[model samples]
Target chain A: MNLTGWKERLFQRYLIWSCRREKIRRYLRDSLPSLPLPDPVDRRSVRVGALQVKLELCKSPIAFADLVHRRVKEAYEAGARLVVFPEYLNLLLFGMLPGIEELEKDYSTGIAAIAKNEQQEQTDVISLPDLFRFMTPAVQPLIFTTFSALAASYHLYIMAGSYTIADQGAIVNRAYLYDPKGELIGYQDKIHLLPVEEEWKIKRGKIFNVFESALGRLAMPVCMDATYFETFRILEERGAEIVMLPIANLEAYNYWLALRGIWPRVQESLLFGVKSALVGSIAGLTFTGRAGIFAPLELTSNRDGVLAEVDCFDNEALAIADLNLDSLHELRCSHPWRDHNPALYRRYFPQVYKR
Target chain B: MLVAALSLAGVDLSSINGYISGLINLLTAQKPVVAVLPAHSALALGLGVGRLNSSNTFQEASAYYFAEGTEWTSEFLNLHGLLAKELQIYLVTGNVIEKDEDLSYQTCYCLNPAGQVCCAQRQTHLTRFEQDLHLSRGDKLDLFRVGNFYTGLVIGNDARHPEVGRIMALQGADLLLHSGAIEGDQTCWQQAAGMWAQVQQNQLYAVEAQLSATIANTVFGGNPSIIAPCETTFGNTGYLARCNPGEPLLCAELDKETLSEIRNDNPLLKLLNFDAYTEICGSEPQ
Candidate 1:
């Protein structure tokens, strides 16, 4: 056999083995809980933090990881039990590679093409799948190891909001959830892929699942998933108490749209929602939002539902707030969920919203 | 488009005719097309039901069920029905104990510009006290047309559920009229905030008229405020009008054209994921 053929076969084998190992590692991590709560579970309140960053073309992947580590440390010091990062975080990793400028140049053109609803053709920039394929397996492992170690060191849960990776011959945007002891608890893939993502051949996820930790049942809905309120409804139905949203919006209008979606979900679902966004300029476009922690507006003294937030837009910010689950449980008695007239609302299902 | 939001200290049932005349005089003087009285304020005056306290007050609320109370309530409704039609103003008021047959519900009355009763909205969600009082829940929702615009009425505690407003918006309502009595003095801010959120979420206009009176030895909280989506003609300021604490009037002009423009520009209502919503939201939890 030719050396090239041998190399391709070996690479395919390596990917399969790596994926299996990763799954087992997650299972092992779950079994070996570093801080398992007692049966009664004394702690009901949890502190959540969101890290907002203005991603730029980085010098190297290692430098980008260091930047993330710095913020994670800040969030930890601020008393955050869980910290969320923004979507497409691995774009920084892409920025560090050679010929990244060429790929960056095509980003706007590709987005504009998608905006115009043009047929997918030859995109000027390297697609997400191509980028993931280009990332050396060794380098990818190093990045994951760093994040895992960071989570382990701080003993905090990290919703490392989406990084693109090749999976079973296709690429998907996956958000990793790490436990306090740095064990891979689970991960959720982006369900609603954007037009630009579709251009990059990013596969959309099929199922939504919630993760159970010491804190509570939490769901991570990457970016556009927030737009589909039904997703949150299912999450609530499945007993998710918190939804960590990691989003990236370059336009001001888009930011407002996303927040508008986030705010109401928490109220309808009766849960806590944290939005961590990518801010600042990336590839000539500006991200215009800050990270925020929101509850049912009734819980806040100001009555705006905002628990804590970074006030300034397009800035590196970390927002942290303590959530009392007991009080939230108390509020459920008054929210009308128990006595809602399901029969009166049934018409909406058949006529307006057929599934 | 002028509106009046009253913050009365109490409802004096002894001089009921004089009290209603005073309200009519104020409406005529202010020249508002719409007037919002506090929730159940009309019932208090008609039935001689004073602010509820631990001890028996002027008369028992159940007295409204008596032949005497019923006569007084009928007279009150007959009088207001003629006055509202004569004024040529669209009026929305609610939570009057409607004792009909064997069922009892707190119903809201919507009076058209012609002074004719157009719609009667009953409270759907009942608070604990309301359940104890055996108030029958509302079965359906109704929207009234005021010229080219549509309005939905939300009674006490009905505003808490978001679906109440959302369903109305989906039915092409441009404004939501809320009238409720909240005993929690601190819940005023939350109600305002909730109303504010509803406007943005539904891309519509809203006005909340809450009861402000001393009852049950506690001062009831009141925040009669109007909320609009940032997409208004005023642009980004989500409130067209707001009242001071215990203020008697809240007035504002609603640009129906601007409301439609905002809804069109964003089009969130039309762009809903109905299939997903049905599959997930409508499903009972397993």
Candidate 2:
């Protein structure tokens, strides 16, 4: 290397380190408050408390209803106000497309009984394929009818991670956040598709969404979408005090790996004002249960990291953490990224997307 | 002893000697030691020896290039520095890509012993294949100095971008370490070698350490004996070490006095301006 070249490299590195040093210092000094408890609906305060998240992978569609009923009772008895299930909780019927013709006959009768809230009266003779098809058609309407009844019966919120609604032939993954009052207060469609599904031509989501719930304005990034940091960043920018990721982490080892791990740390450091929890289920072949809660940004040896992590692979477990919203608001006041020279970044990477 | 080399722009070549000697003085005196880990390629998971694919998809491929490896690499580098005692291990963040839908590369990060990223810089230019892959272009060139020792890092394809090495020199990097994977060159082997020579000329003490043959599906096979000033590259064993230019696992001690004399004699730092170049390039239509 020549004399001139060497000096140039030194100066460039200096600028970068200078920028990072400030960020690191900011992360160390500013300690955000813990999550606040859920207050009355009329109050503007953010609620942070013990919320137990459980992911139950019902092997098939036939056993799903029974599992849901039993789990609800157990979770309620254990004092869980909100419980979540994967995209197709009715897996009992999801795998049976081959016998659609035969299944449809039984499905029509069962749908009628389920619609009328007479679940016990519904015939159990229906095949899995029939049930799977039944779960697809009028998914939203039927889901409300069933989960609302369950929510009313238990007086708890069932944040169904997602269910594919057959819009014509195209299925849209949608999550329904049901209130204890049997009202569906929030709904979010899965924005990113599985790579295979993407290859199959599923329509990419047109909306980057965050919905206001009793706990906080929650942002849900479906499955693969969480891999993209923008979704989480957008949630923070849009006043989403709490970010809930309801995903099917069907990777080979049930490992969320880097996406599940490092990203939350980055978010905590830069956007110290938000508490993010990712609840994932292993539905694939090696269903090593990796379900967990990512609490607000906290100090970990000078770097910001996840306050808590739930189990990655297991049958069923609830990871709980306290997230105080008041502290988040306080941290926002002193955020460095929020005060960065926007003009400089704009001038640098002109094509960068903004939410 | 792993030495990686990269190309530099003519503008940065003027002050290269002083920068290198100053760094040597800092190392000799303050003794800030660092472990510079190269970023693994995305191919590490898709079709390489390293089992970085903890997850199933190609998306995990990005992690192979720069994720927990960044964590482990940083941690390991810190450990190396500790082993050297007074040597403070500074991690060189090779070029790192951002987590984007487009899956483009971002800034490279190097960690200090405290696990803090002490220095980081992005590759401002994209190579041919990188452009084909649609990698995002970076803006500023960066070089970091800790105590006195300074090093510029280039990861994977960034090794091929001359501006990165040059920019590092202008910013005051003493020695340039380039971490990359050189898949076997097809028929255009000579052209690639010529490119390497250009980079070496541009960045005075340029060192290019490649992952072993098994790891990278290496294409370049020039005798390391005639290549590096050091007698070894980091992490590779099976080389003839006593040769003059050295071999892989090649380690070289910089001649601080000689380097300093060169910089004093050719003090062209002010004459070659970056502002003028950027002004012209910035206005050019892409």
Candidate 3:
């Protein structure tokens, strides 16, 4: 192999070794806090928890685990049957790696320097997809195990947010859903990619999956997927009752832009929408949005689509609300939305989407 | 190019001509490239005698106002055509077009600067009220070229469906004109889901004109506004200009350059996965 190839292989080997399960467990043992697991929720209606988590650099895998565990525990204690975290929550594991601190520092300084119109010596900055590709092998196992353990411990269905992993040689943003038994129910890959994701060479997912669970039909679509109505429309057509969207928006919070997602999607499809957002700054990029649970305007008591939303944009908080599936089903049946012109859509959707 | 939306409140059926003349005076000052008027602004003249919620009254009023070959339809068209020609601006407005003695369609008409009908889209999705009134549904969606923009027209509740906007965007429409009349109480969420969401999702500019007058027991109320995608608007609010109470006209410049830049950067339509949607909407046409 060439010198560059050899160097790349060596770095991958180091990452794999550093991300071993035993090392992660040892780190967690030191950093994880002991908290009592709350009794399981025994309500007729399913309560959902949306975690608006602030992006933070963790010192070790244990710190990341501790952060996730605390949020999950809080949701469980609050009697949420389903808990959702924000997209790219797995990226926090970067802090545990040996060389990422320097990279993070460089990224922050580079961004600042660019903003100030100051010239600095150029350094090779790694792209997000490449970084995730190299680190996925090491981090994927830990993410799965940690979320699986949390789901089992809390006895709650957990949408473990989204992570970029190398899938069939292409890096895809994928969201996983874990059952109360800690078993992997299903996962939905993000169908739509942002402009940055396209530039970073992240491949888009091709299919939509709606998983059947105790809390009716649930589908988890990560971030940008919710921007398009087709995502929710297709899921709703497939009998998805509740749709979970985990977003880490890379911009300042704007109420109008935020409304383009779950709020209107819920109104259009007459389905319950749960949104979990990643806020604050990390690696020179700022993410700002409020996590919220949404329903149709008629279903809401106040006739506003928002059921519950995080009060602040840039801080960590949990928004919990109960979803009455029975009422939603009734609304779906009674409403005139079922009168949608399928033939009209068939004429244009196929031709338009093909273009 | 500057586009305008008109919201009419307390419209008097007795002085419909005077109302049109006043509207023309208002538009003559702004001289927008295009002006959009709300749905049923002219046809609701029949509602002066009856309640909108009464099925028998609605049916009788619709027939008398639209299907009876009344002079109001021709007069309404002539006034709008004159406005379009005199101002040299494209006029998009909604009116009930009689198809037959038994059928009348709630249609959105696009009148070009030549005072000619360029395109007409009948409301494809009818509300419960319209269905009870026995109005015929339009079968096709169409787009027309006005000035430098390809524009699409959606009437009333037709804007509620995302499919209509998506289809128009696919047909290369950069501007969507929604002419609507909201009856009874309208919530903010309902408004957000209409043209606002359409512009954001389709990455197009939209002008929503609403009728805000009360006829009998029915009260039509909404804020008319010119909307662009949030990224292109001030404060990312997605609204360029919104009509306030006592203000019927809202005018805003539709910047093609900004829209092109936003669409180029996002390219939401180009990124749509056809294979996935095909599963929900059925297989591609042979």
Candidate 4:
């Protein structure tokens, strides 16, 4: 097991003991007989929450985790059972480390030097993945240590936004899921990379992952994964009812551009999506967007097929809303996939429509 | 530049003659590069008056439809022909119950600017009510070149399926034309599905032409619209033009420039999981 997984169990034990007061507060509320249980099984809904953060540059990896913990606790107090944070949450780690400002300046100079010498020499390209190798050893474990402890303490599931971590010989962006018990449930790596990411030499992930949860079957397709229909098909085949997306858009900063294909993915797959976006400027990149909760026809329908969204942009904000699993159950027949004969549609797959 | 999504309300044998004059007026009014009419705008079947519902609720609808060219189509085309040289109006004929030598289905004809049929498609998927009407299904989904845009064709119920739209997107279609007749008394089940569903999922532009007339006791939807990809509009996205049940036209410009711009900003095409997508079945697309 890795350091985070090993330390996670120990951290969880400490959290459970320290959070005894919170357990008593919950006990007091449930002790009342008048408050009936909120329906069971197919009839019930889960109140999922999302945090949109224009996260500040951190001074330390530990401090970054502390910031995330405060937001997770806020979501729990607002009555959210599950909470998701925005992408590139680990960027704060680099910001937090001492002398990072100098390292960044040196890194920029190195990049420019490499660009100028590209025609003269035949060596390796300087990528962000290479830059990550320098930071992984010192701060990677603590990032996971923080998330695992926070999940156990708050007693809420957390889809911690992705961070680049060294794997094999390359670096891949991986999102971690922490169950309420604080166990490392599973992780999904990003399958699609942006053009800038390609230049950074960030290797792409190959698999689409689905994990079982107490609430229902859940999946996480980081940002660009939702742009592809095949990603939804794989999740749907696995019977995923909820899909959470952790997205980050840099430079473009347009809310619509960041959230372009969301409705189509949820609607086509009959999945509820809880979107968490990173909003703010960072490393010459300005991320802008308000996180959204949605089903199909997201903002198009009169009911908007959802419950809540971020109130504003470029600042930290959150909203929690009940998503009816019952509504999804009832919609099985009406969804267009009902009429499709997959056996027949298979013929169209191999043919190239567009490269 | 004007694409007209027209309302054909209460269209039956008695009022067929008046439709000719109205159609002529539209064809002559300030010429359009390409104009469009809704499916089932030719005749109305009396499904509005009857409904089949169960105890606490019961519902029924008319299943009858009239074939185009009985009188309305010919007269409408004759007028459209006068401007056919300059204006190319997509005459999406009203839905019809048709029968070949060995099969029967409900179908619509997508005609070119000169009033010549470009392609014909039947409803590949049937709703519960359409199945009750004993409608046959069509097997092919095809795309057509309308003026400068590579457009794909889909009927009302087909918009609910993402694969259908994805296939068109994959085939390099710039715009999708959705022609269908949705129920007017749509209060509960009709809120979420339709043209917008296809547009968003495909992440492309679409011009929707919906049946906007009441035939007999049946109320057809008149909310024909034009929608752009949400990215280009910056979350200020949705129908650029949408008409209410009482309106006659939902007219708007097809902003291909903005569509191209959004597609460039977010190139979803390259992001596809083609390795897995094509791996589902080993055979090539026929």
Candidate 5:
């Protein structure tokens, strides 16, 4: 708290910062910008085709990271300026817990803590080794490094929808939006969680957030929040041009209704204004083919007419579309639906959100 | 004849109690009252008020919100001002002023249709944010009349509380002017209901204008403006404007005659049942 103590601490912190900086420099000589990757055809002026966003339904927790890495590379090849993937992509890489013998050798200490905590709760405590019989740690950093490198290498934007990761000791569900330079520009922690999935050790987000970047303003409302039109309305009010949603859309009537039915109704309600691109996913069941783009309701951008929808029920191909930022504004100006006012009709209804 | 303009959109709390003397005076007033719909904007576009800080320039402050936020009342007033240059344009606001509550006293300006402020609303709602910070909510619901129409301004969220709308209506308000924001599809259902109530129950007009989006939800079209009738079951009809990022302006016309026909048929406004109903209700069903 004193000046001298603060000075000493500041100096020590600076030293640590420089050391970390130097270590990264040693591995990655010079800033990644100096590297000569071919220019992207200078297509910034030309309006691209329909915006196609793909969600790589990763099978294993460890596979989640690699899947994003691979799909991002594919998206770049497909010429997608923005690409999104689902929640908990990295955790899937660890695969399920490994067998008991391997768990005993590899995770005995961690498992003991789990057993002790379980016993305290008055529940049956399975040994870590026994639990490992089904799942194994996939080394999350391996996946992180791969996506980070790919983003840096390809000069693309990526929305790795909420993922469960350890920071210090807590497991948090975090969303990261990487810029064209592969720099992590925006971070939104999931504010809401699925009531059914409690084991993921996820924490709720305290704020509804938005992010600004070179492409435009973007925000992600994890999974459940996407269903709340208020979330999108607030985002639109806040100047969010595009909303990237990375959902683990499961196969249920409600989920299906959201992806197909309700989303279109929302698109119509715009009266003639606000056009936001919907890029999202449904994890686990790849069969329903849940990932795709929802726009064209307001024809500012080229009607790529749903450029691509992937078969998520299985290991499938990616959805592709060329997104044009200018077209969004242009359409808003031209469409009447965007400008209609309902108060003129003399109708007033009340809306309430229940916890 | 002098005309007074009023709009009550999405706020139902302003409905007058039938037994109250305030309700009787409001129903008997004679004026060519027209209620206009609230204006619309995008979600990211903060209302103009969000930008007015102690030191920021008006231009710099305005940039903090999307251009659409300031366009609603300013645009509509400017358009109407042009049509009736010699006629007075009385406007109403729906919520507390978004920014510069201090300036709200000076906010009302009378403009000549060219979109200049001919008149502005005094702050009607309590100091919303500054009460905890540096300001307090305004206690007075200020009133002004142009032509035969008596007008008052209440913030948009205030419309949900009927008293704000009813107070103005009771003080010989032929119409109410509302300006604020509402986000999403449910707005359609709510706005429709308000239009019906204002015309049938109040026997008056309420013009509702609103901003399209809020800071929380960024997916919406334009403000759905409605002109509610004081009679009939036609419901409210008008235009739904797109949000700034999405589309263009939507316009519609409201037939004023519907007010007369509904008033003639609906006997609920004339019948005396409050005494019996109150007595039974007050007895507590022993």
Candidate 6:
């Protein structure tokens, strides 16, 4: 075998050894006793929880599981039937690698270090998509099992945020949903890619899926997908009652920029929107957003469209609110979003998109 | 470039000629490259003879408000067109243009600096009030040019539909001019659903001029403002300038460089999934 082939095999083995499942399970078992007791579930309305998770680097898979388990437990204790986490949730698994914490403190230095480690002589910077592609095989299983176990153990439905993985030689950001029985419900790939993602060669997904769950018909669209109205319109047309958005915004939190997402979408689509945010910093990129649960202004008691929201942008907190399905159904029936001129749209959308 | 938005309140339809003279004087002072007036500002003149009240039926209200017909609309357009030429600025105004005897459409007219009607966009989406008045819906979306910027116009409730603004952006519009009105207090959600969200989604500069007059027993009020993409605006608030209740005029400069930067940085339109939208549009609404 060639020397380069041997080195690649060794690197793969090291990643597998670093993310071994036994350590993660041991951490989960040890952390179980410290978790809060579950609150009695309310049968009247669907209580949803959105987590504003502070970004953290873990020393191993165990530490990542501990961070995730604690948040899941807290939401369950708060009587939340369904809980959502932020985008790039599995990207936190990078924390499990040795020396990654110091490297991630600065993006340029991290890229330099990765390039040196990978022995890429042709380029000074390593491709982020390629790095994620290599890491996916080792990390994807850990992410799935951890969320599945948490969902089943808590008897709660979970939108486990999003993971960027290599699919058919293309990187795509995909969001996953787990039912109460720990079964995989379905997944929705992000339809809109941020410019940075485009730089990393992440391909945009072509389909929007509305998954049928115990709570209701739910659609999961990651971060930038919420920036476009077509995402919500398509989901609404497909009969999605609840839309879960997982955001890891790269920009500083401005109230108006934040309004560009799920807040106005709920107003436009008349669908309940649950948004989970990843806050703090990773890879020298700062993420700031408030986790929020939004409904139509008329349905909300304050008529503000925001049902519940985290108090601050950078802090970790859970925003929980009861989604009155009956009220939503009534609003939908009355408003009936039938005014969307499909005939007018059919003219421009095809020609415009064709360009 | 400097842009201005005018909100008309307590306008007496009896002396609209005096109102237009005062408006032209105000625009001359501001000297904006473009100015936007509120929806139904010109058509309100018809309401002068037969004033609307709570007792009037839909038929009564429609007849009374549209009595002036196309001849009056032509005079109104000529008035605004001459005003645009006099000020040497692009002007956008809304009027109810009668199509034959039975049909009338809520149209937004954009008059160029040359005082010529460059483009007219009819409201594709109708409000409950417009529907009750039996207003005809417009079919095509069009764009006009203001200086170097390709601009689109949306009247009243058309701003509520994201598709209108998006199609304009797709057609290479960098600026959107909206003339709309709301009965009673404008809610936060209602405001967000208009130009603010449109600017964010389309990454374009927008000027929204709202009508703030009371006709019938209903009181109309809105905050007229100039808006831009959040990243380009001061404090990232998405508003370059917003007028208060009693304030009728707002003027602000739109930075072309900043708008280009925002669009270049994000390029959201390029990422749109057209095939998926096509499939969704083809499917029946659930």
Question: In model 5 chain A, where is the ten-residue run with the lowest total lDDT?
Answer: A346-355
Off by over 4 Å in 6: A1-8, A14-44, A105-127, A336-338, B10-12, B48-63, B66-75, B100-102, B113-115, B280-284
Q: Choose the strongest candidate by TM-score.
A: 6
Ranking by DockQ: 6, 3, 1, 4, 2, 5
The TM-score of candidate 4 is: 0.79
**Candidate 6: Cα lDDT at B71:** 64
Candidate closest to the true structure, highest DockQ: 6
Taking all chains together, the TM-score of candidate 6 against the true structure is 0.90
Q: Which ten residues in a row have the lowest lDDT in candidate 3 chain A?
A: A112-121
Model 2: per-residue Cα lDDT at residue A166: 52
lDDT of 6 by residue, B163-236 (tens): 88888998999999999776667544577777788888889999999877765545568878898988887898
By lDDT, the better pick of 5 and 6 is 6
- Stretches off by above 4 angstroms in model 1 are A1-42, A97-114, A117-146, A163-174, A181-183, A189-208, A223-233, A249-264, A297-306, A333-339, B1-14, B47-73, B184-188, B233-235, B279-286
* Prediction 3 TM-score vs. true: 0.90
Each prediction's Cα lDDT score? 0.68, 0.42, 0.79, 0.63, 0.40, 0.79
* Count of steric clashes across candidates, in order: 3, 94, 0, 20, 171, 0
lDDT of 1 by residue, A253-324 (tens): 433344555776776667889899887765556667778898986687677678988877777899998888
lDDT of candidate 5 over A50-76, digit per residue (tens): 222333333333344445455566666
Q: Write the per-residue lDDT of candidate 2 for residues A249-346, one digit (tens) a residue.
A: 44443222323322332343233222122233322222233444444333222223444445444345554444555555565664322222223233
DockQ of each: 0.22, 0.03, 0.46, 0.21, 0.02, 0.55
Using lDDT as the measure, name the better of candidate 1 and candidate 4: 1
Better structure of 1 and 2 per TM-score: 1
Predict model 1's lDDT versus the native: 0.68
Q: Candidate 3 docking: what grade?
A: acceptable
CA lDDT, candidate 4, residue A208: 81
Error of 3 at A94 (Å): 0.3
Each candidate's interface RMSD (Å, one decimal) is 4.3, 17.8, 3.9, 5.2, 19.1, 2.3
